[model samples]
Structures are given as structure tokens and as C-alpha cells.
Target: MLGEPSYTMNDLFAQLGLDSSDEAIDAFIEENKLSKDEKLVEADVWSEKQCMFLQEEWKKDAAWAIVIDELNVRMHPTA
Candidate 1:
């Protein structure tokens, strides 16, 4: 039997329908730092669909959760 596919930041970005290139991901992270009180799913940087996808995946603790949590941490440097 095969294990479930692992995900990365690039895959998460692509799933979110955003630019998935390393440089683009880096640029996006640098540009979108969130304050400690800010929430990743509620960030203005995402479209409504993007927000829903993130929130749903996170709530479900799906396979994408690891990458999503990674993104949340990167975005909230103050946290």
C-alpha cells in the first residue's frame, strides 16, 4: 500500500490558486506578514475561495494541514 502524498509550500500555494514558484512564494510570505493577533484564514491577502479552502483544510486537519500550518507560522512572524 502506498502512503498518502506529502505536501509542500509550493503545493499549498498551487492548491490555493496562487503563484507556486519558490521565488513567488518567498515574495508573498515577505509581503504578507501578519500581526500576532491576525488569523491566517481571515487575512486580506486571500480571496474568499482561498480563505474557505484554508479554513476547511485546517478545520479538518487534512493532509494539507501541515503545509497550511507552516504557512500560518511564516505569515505570523510575531506569533
Candidate 2:
């Protein structure tokens, strides 16, 4: 159902132009994290495709919603 993750965490990271490897993903998250006070749409690190993917998935808000939300929460705010 809705609780199941649609995209693998790796794939999701790749779509954002981040390394898809687990360790790299972790490091990327660490390096690009929001201040626990920002949203993904506000982040500037995403490539145009990455940004579009995130934005569209956010709009879909279905199976992809969970991972999109996670990405949104972790992305740093645009400088």
C-alpha cells in the first residue's frame, strides 16, 4: 500500500544526481542536509531533472510521495 517505498533509496538518490551507492548516499545526505528547518523544494543542489522529479513526485503524492517527502526534508535550503 502507501507505506511501501516505491523507489529504492539508491535510485531516489541517483535521480537527484547524488551517488546511488549506500555509503555515498549517506555522505551526500550528511553533506547536504537541511538545518532540520528546511524543505526540498527550497534546496538548490538538485539538477534541473532532479528538481523536476522531486517536484512532480511531490505533486503526485502517491507511491512516490514517501521518498519524495524524505528527500524534501533532507535537502538544504537554497542559499
Candidate models: Cα lDDT each? 0.93, 0.72
In model 1, which runs have C-alpha deviations exceeding 4 angstroms?
none
Worst 10 residues of 2 by lDDT: 70-79
Error of 1 at 28 (Å): 0.2
For 1-79, candidate 2 gives per-residue lDDT tens digits of: 7576678778787767777998997787778777655567666677788778878888988677787766655555443
Please report the TM-score between candidate 1 and the true structure: 0.94
Per-model TM-score versus the true fold:
0.94, 0.72
TM-score of predicted structure 2: 0.72
Root-mean-square deviation of every model: 1.5, 4.0
Q: What root-mean-square deviation over C-alphas does model 1 reach?
A: 1.5
User: In lDDT terms, how accurate is model 2?
Assistant: 0.72
